[model samples]
Structures are given as C-alpha cells and as structure tokens.
Target: MGNFAKGYSMKDRQFWVIVMSLGGASVFVFAAMYSVQPLLPFFTEQFQISVSYASLSMSMTTLSIIIGLMVLGFLSDRYGRLPFVRFSILLTIIPFLLMPLTDSFAVIIFLRFIQGFAIAGVPAAALAYISEEIHPQSMGLATALYISCNALGGTIGRLMMGYLTENKSWEIAFLCLAFFGSIIFILVWLTLPKSRNFTIHRRFIREDLYGFWLHLKNPYLLLLFGFGIILQLSFTGMWSFIPYYLVEPPFLLSLKMISFIFLAYGLGIIGSPIANALANKVGIAKIRTIGVLLLVGGILCTVSTSLALIVVGLCIACLGFFTTHSLTSATVSRTASHQKGLASSLYLVSYYIGVAAGSTLLSPIWLHFKWHGIVIITVLLPIIYLFFLNYTLHKKMP
Candidate 1:
C-alpha cells in the first residue's frame, strides 16, 4: 500500500484513497490542460502567427475535453469507475511526454486534443465516487479538497511554467510536465483503491444513450447544466485572456511578475471548502447567489490598471468562481438517483461546451473590444445564472 493509502483508515477505502490521491490524480488534468496557457504568446511570437491563431492551443484542448467529459462520464456508468479512471490516467501520460518532442503547431494541437480526452478520468469519476461511497456528511469536505487540488495545481503549474518559460524554451515547460506526470502516474496507480460502489454491466450503446437522454430531460438537470456553462464561460474567458491583458500596455508586467497573479488561484483552494460549509448552513442556492454577485463585483473591480486593484479583484473573483463551481458540481452529483456517471457527464458537457464556444467567440471580441470586451462578453451568462439561482433559492430545492 502507498503511504497515503495506508494513512487514512476509513472503511470506505475508495473514499479516503480518493481524498489522498486527488493531488496526484489532478496533476494529470492540470498539467495537461493549463500547462499550455502560459506558452500562448511564446508560440505566437516564435511562429510568427496571429494571436488569434495561437489561441488555438487553448481552444483545441477544450474542444477535446468536451468529447472526453461526455463520453468518459457516460462510460463510467456501465463499465465501472476504477477501470475508466485508471485507463484514462495511463493513456493521458502519453501525450504529455510526447508534447515536448514536437515543433509543428498542427501536431502539438493534435496531441493536446488527445491529452484532454485522456485526462477526463479523475474529475468525472471522482465526483461519482464521492456521491456513491462517502457518507453524506463527509462528502462536502472530500469534494472540496479534491477541487482544491485542481485549483492549486492550475495556479502552481501556470506560474511555475510561466517563470520557467522566461528562462527556457516553451518545450522545457511541456517536458517538465512530462516528468512530473510520470511520478503522479505511479502514485495514482498505488493510491486509488478499488471502489465498493462499483458494478460492471454490459455496454449497450442504445440503452446508455437513452439513459443519458432521460437524465438530461429533467428541467432541474437542464438548470444545473446551464449553471455549469455559465461557470465555465466566465472563468475560462478571463483565464485565457488575463496573461495577454497583463503583458500588453499599461500593465507591461513580466512573466515572473504576472505569475504572481496566479497566487490568486490559491484563494480558490480556500474558497472551495468555505463555500461548501456555507452551503451546508445557509443552503446552496442562497450561497451560490452570493458567489455570483462576488464574481460580478470582482470583475468590475479588475477593469482598473492599478496593480493592487487588479490583484485584489482577481483574488475575489477566484474565490467566488470556485465557490460557485463547488456548489454546482456537488449538487449535480447528489441530485441523481442513479447513473451519477451520466449525470456528471451531462453537467460536464455543458461545462466544456462553454469552454469551446467561449474560445470560438473570442476572435471577434478580441478583434473589437480586447480584454474588456472579453469580460463583458462572458459576463452575461453569469448574470443570467443569477436569475436562475434566485428562482432555485425561492423554491428551496436541491
């Protein structure tokens, strides 16, 4: 047994192992996903491509992530969580190792798409695993910790890579990811205990398709999906463009200096658990409204060129977004009667749909409005989500 696997002595082995292994497991997702964002301008400058064209690195991974979230999440329902989780982790490592070997933008994008697909295992399976295996009282903390790993990894990876890129080639950043992912791979293999809530079944495409369709047919399910979309569109649009905004006029921040901004991501790690605890006390619907309002307020504050204002605003925004995401994700996992894999899948579909659509629409927005336009463009979804959250609060349903 791994040191982590042996340390936590919950009878529900899957639950505690998941809590422990998430730091290692989430590196697969974050290392694969956000590792490239810091390198976007590097690619544009080196390749002599337009900024819009270089943005494809961000776009391709998200587009592929949509396919992974839907397909992988659904398959976990029929085949079982452990197999899907392990298979996805093992497969994802290949693209990380291969990414640094390429010079061609086309090949790198292709590899990034594949990397996105392979890394869907931990997040989708972790959610279903929590809902199924953990006691209801304990699920909130477990979910919060798991999500905190994601936020922490994202912040650290981007900042580390951004600093590294200042001193080395972009290839060095991807290569570093490949090395770290290898260690995480071994840890995940050891630390992910076999799931008790698992049952294997025949894979029937038609029946499973019908199950997913029925799952999505609910108004409440659709509501969750809409919130997921809002969360993604708002969060990703800001993240994808923030480095660009900072490096350009007025701010003119260095890569190392801008990396300091990612320290705001640590607020997400803090906000996740606090938000869940607040939800437990005050109700998720009510807490979620507060979260969205904080997000809007933070974005409004970030429009300034003042360094302190930008840092504070980004910190507040990260907290709000992370809290909102925590509540929404936990709700999706808990609301389902069965086929949580499918429910998780449906939620992620909306999530990644926002990711794809957000990137696609950025071309026109960046052309016309730049960073402010991106903020205004993405803000509407959250604004509408506030209305839905108000409706949910009045009704007081899960």
Candidate 2:
C-alpha cells in the first residue's frame, strides 16, 4: 500500500509484494500466450492442417496481442495500469476454458486471438508500472526478475501442455492451464498494490496521438523498437519450429521429450538478472552485443546432429535472447521522457509482431529448407541487425 516519492526499494516489504505479484501475474500471462507453441504438431494432426496452418494458432494470438498492446497501453495511460493488469489475467482464462469445448480449428484460432489480446494488458502496463513504482536503484533487478518469470511461465506452459497432450489430451492441457491462471489471478488481486506514481493523462485523443507520433519519430527509440523485433523474430522462429524438427529425422524426439527442451528456458530465468547486473558494469550496449553474439552462436550449434549439442545450443540461445530482451525493454522504459505506457506498448507491439512473423512467416523456410534453412535465416537476421544497432548507437553517442 506504500507508494513513497522515492518508490519501493529492496528493503521494503511492499517492494517484494509488488514484484512478486506482478511477477506471478506475468508468469500466467506469458504461459497462456505461449503454451500453444509445443502443441503445433498436435494441432496439425488433429485438424488435418498443414504445418503453416497449425502455426496460425500461435501467430493469430501474437497478432491479436499486437493490436491489443496499442489500444490497451493507450487506455492504461488514460485510466490506470492496475486495472488492465487485473483484467488481462481474467480475460485470459476465458479462451482456455472455451478452446477445449470446440472442435473446429477456426473456432480455436479465433479463441486464441482473443486470448492473445487479453494477454497484452500485462506487458502494456506492467513495465510502465515498474518504472513508475519501483525505486530506480532496484528497477533493473526488478525488471529482470519479472522478465525471468515471463520465461518461467512460457517454459511451464509448454512443458505442461506437451506432457498433458502426450498422456491425456490437448483439451485437458488447456483446462489445466485455465485452472492455473485462476490461481494466479487470485494471488494478483490480493497482492498487487494500487499505483501511487501514475499521473492520469486526461488529454484529448489528438494529444495522445501526438505522443505516440513523437515516440515513433525519435530515432533512438525507433532503434530500440527495431531491436525488439529482431530479437524476438529469431528467438521465436527457433522455438516455433524446433518441435517439428525434433520429431523428425534421426532425432525423432516425442512431444514429451520436446517439452523438456524448454528447460533451456530456465537459462533465460538466470540470464536476465545476471545480464542486467553485468550491463550495470560493462554498459548495456556491450552486454547486448555479447547477448546477440551468443544468440547467433547458439543457433549455429543446432546444426550439429547430436541431441546433446542441440539442447546445449538451445540453452545458449535462451540465455542470449533473454539478456538482450531484458536490457532492451528496461532501456525503453527509461528512454521515453513521457507517456511511458505508450512507449512500452510500442516496444511490445514490435516485439510480438516478431512473434507472429516468426511463427507464420518463417513457415516457408521450414517448408523448403527444413531445420537447416531455419538456422540460416534466424542466425543471419539477428547478426545483420546487431551491426545496425551498434552503428546506430555509436553515431548517436558522440
């Protein structure tokens, strides 16, 4: 309940409460958004659809989230952050409950889209909330912790769905996720503090539009936003197709085994906080560059036929991806001089657009080139972007 002028620090009980609540809520949000990833092949089999078509289940959700982030982020700036955060979790449960009852693939995709839009509320507001409410000294760690939970949630969801689908059914997997979401919702409601630092922007629609335009016009901010797109495009593209790749050829891993691969995401949980701490010492740019290099290197390692190497590569990839992501996101929150909610939303909009594109747009690469093709494109894209990012930052700094 405390919202001091200096914001909550590590020593405060309220600080832990807020961080844990938001972190828990983030876990549910990301888990619901990404749980369908491991089940793409199952959907392909169940619906008798193409691999690309089954990917729509993942893409459609992220696509809807893009739209939701813009609208909800704008609204949160006008109203409040806490409401959208609360409402997002509540809305997320509905689709999980509904998806299991339907037989049609179209219906399932539509529900997933709704669920993705609902999931947007948290990212749109939560980062902005942390920037406004948490003490600056602790904000880096706080953001990293929240993002780490995001990784944890995605890992849990994929693992849970993969396990349940293999043993029981995909339907049971979704229902179980819904039940888990309800538990997260209750914890969030009880523990989340009201925002003390948020100042309502009651301005007209035109003014808000201008604020968005200003953010878009800032070259530095645009670079960060583009970085978000590149980071997720490669990361999501890698994960989206791995299940299919492992289920084929010499590897031929089962869905249950494939789910365990997400344990690499545990590296992401550790990577964020560590990267944030290092960025404080070596500089964010240096850490981010290292992160991108790690990402590229890890993707290349997957070319090895050895199963152990593939898993090791994935661990490296997860670490790099989360490190870059956590730093970029925290920087975005700090860079915007005003309308932090809108700025955070724009970053995520670009971020999830990468998710949608990686899931669906890369289908052709998967189709024609297979895993090798995927490796080429995913690796190349980030490297190309990293050069661009460094060059841009270097020019701007002097």
Candidate 3:
C-alpha cells in the first residue's frame, strides 16, 4: 500500500509519477472518446447520411459515457480508484480493435458506445483520486495538468484519425488508435501508484443513491453543474460542425487541411494551467467569468468570413473553454464535502450531456442556418448563462 499519512506534493518524486500516470490515463480516455469527431464528414459522405445523423458517431459515445460515469463512479467509491482507472484504459482498446473488422456503420456506432462507457472509468475516478492523494497546495496545478492532457489527447486523436482517414482508410485509423491505446495502458498500469488516501466505502445502494440526491440538492453544485453543460455545449457545438463548414465554404479545404485546425486544441493545453495560476492570484470565480467572456468573444469571431479570423477564433475559443473547464472541474472537487467521486461523476455527466447535445441538438441549426445560426445560438447561450452564474453567486455570498 502506498503511504497515505501525508499527501504527495510537487517536491516529491511520487507526485510526478501519480500526476503523469493519471494524466496519461486522461489522454487515452479523451483520445478514444473524440477520435471520431473529425470523421463525421467522412462518415456522412461514405454512409450517405445527413450531417446530424453522421454526428451519432460522436454523440452516441458521449451519451454512453454519461451512463458509465454514474455506474463506474459509484463502484469506484465503494471499491477503489486505481482499479477503475486501469479498467477504463483496458476496456477502451477493445472497441478500436473491433471497429476495423466491420463495415457496418451501425456496428461501428454500437462499438463506439461501448468504448465510451469503457472510457468513463478513468474520469469517473481520477479527480477524486487526485483530490485525495495530491497535496492541497498542489491540487489545482495537478488537476490543470490532467485536464490539459485531456485536450492533448483529443487533439492527437482527432488529428491522427483525420489524417489517416484522408490518406489511408478510417479502418486503418482505428487500428493505429488501438495500438496507441495499448501503449498508454501499459504505462498507466506500471506507473500509477495505489491510492493511499482512498477510504473504501462499503455503503448500501440506497445510501449511495441518497448521496447522489444530496449533491443534486446543493444549489451551488447545481450552478457548477449547469456551467459544465453550457461550457461544453458551446465548445462542442462549434467544433462539431466546423469541419462541415470548412469543407463547403468559399475557401474549400481537404480533410488533411482541416485536421490542422485541431492544433487550436493546443491552446487549451496552455490555457488550463495558466487559468489555475491566475486563479491563485485573483480568484477562481473572477477568472472563470473572464474565461466565459473569452469564449463568447471567440465564438463571435468565427462568424467572420476570413479564414485567418476563423482559425484565430478557434484558438481563442479553445483557450477560453479549457480555462473555464479546468477551474470548474477543480471547484466541483472542492465544493463537494462528501462523496467526491459521486460529485465529480455528476459534474461529468452534465459535461458529456452537453457534448451529446452539441453534437446532435445543434444539428438542426447547422442544417438550416449553417455556421451563422450555430454562432448565434452558441454565443447567446453562454452570455445569458454568465449573467445567471453571477447572479447566483452574488445571492449566495454573505
């Protein structure tokens, strides 16, 4: 058993091991989850489906992840965190391997759904693991680093799949992803230390349900949960349709060229830790609000016809989204006094629901209004939610 009497800090060798291992776990989780996003357009052309229908390749996965987070998170709370983390990565590899053997789109979607549920194990348990194992002073930075890895995984996954699909075949892409997942799994299994701080809860099912209900009843947590939905809804909605938008526009681009746009996600890698550092100086709430404003502004920028402006807008949007997401995620861990695992799970449930909603719900807007309509709705929703967030926070303050 690892030492749990004292939390690991930046100065300790074990701290880097834990953070890097968990961070790699996060990378694989997200990489597997979002790998198909760039392929939405390709799926549409190949399968002879509509844009919205093709999006099921993405949404179905997120939808399953929502369910998996609840189950895996609850289980992890009772069992242990490390097991779920390892289980998630191992499960993630199966779908990728099987996806290449079948030509049926429905089969692929079913496999993606299963893959998504498998991917949830890591996220369902990871934040709570960090909260318990890492030193309080280092928690924010640790969480930020983990979240940044989320962006890195997503960017890498999309770019890899996109490029491979354009040059080779989507089947080839899935095979490569499977090979990559294997490497990540080995590293995490070997390097991730056992949780010393985890206190196994052998509670009744009824008691766990009640714990979930209690978190739902907390008004502040509800606000944070709501924020998670809005942030991802806007962010995902923008990225989901951007490929279609670029493929058709006056400035037509190939899948290979469009894949490069995911580099914008790199800004997310930078934004998360920077947001954490700034929050330390100012305040989390204030910085979070600034992050939202940046998101709103960045979305509006994409409305422009200029390609340069659109690319710039994407970078800004990624930065803003990650900044808000990193802070919101950390705050959720801090806010829940009990059942941190359940709270984190609930927060992610809301988060991925936004992902599902953005991928599917925004389809009509893209179908009818195109990029203009998407921009209007995505920009307006967050700005309105920002006011609501401020009002709720003020009302709660003494």
lDDT accuracy of residue 260 in candidate 2: 91
TM-score of every candidate: 0.90, 0.97, 0.97
Better of 1 and 2 by lDDT: 2
**Model 3: CA > 4 A from native:** 1-3, 396-398
- Candidate 2: misplaced stretches above 4 Å? 1-3
Off by over 4 Å in 1: 1-15, 388-398
Across residues 1-398, which tens digit of lDDT does each residue of candidate 3 receive?
23456688888888899889998888888988889898898999998888888899899999999999888888888889999999899999999989889888999989989998999998888888888898887777788888889999999999998999999999999989889888989999999988888887889989989999999999999989998999899999999999999998686889988888998888999999999889989999899989998888888998888989999999989999999998898889789999777787888899999999999999999989999999998999988998988897898843
Query: Compared with the true structure, what per-residue lDDT tens digits does model 2 show for residues 1-398?
Result: 34488689988888899889999999999999889999998789889999999999999999999998888987988899999999999999999999889899999999999998899999888888888899988877788899999999999998999999998999999999999999999999998988999888788888888989999999889999998998899999999999999999899888999999988888999989999889979999889989999998999999999999999999999999998998898789789998776787788889998998899999999999999999999999999988987887788754
How far off is residue 329 in model 3, in Å?
1.8
- Candidate lDDT scores, in order, read 0.76, 0.90, 0.89
lDDT of 1 by residue, 198-227 (tens): 656686788778878887787777788888
Predictions: Cα RMSD each: 3.4, 1.4, 1.6
lDDT of 1: 0.76
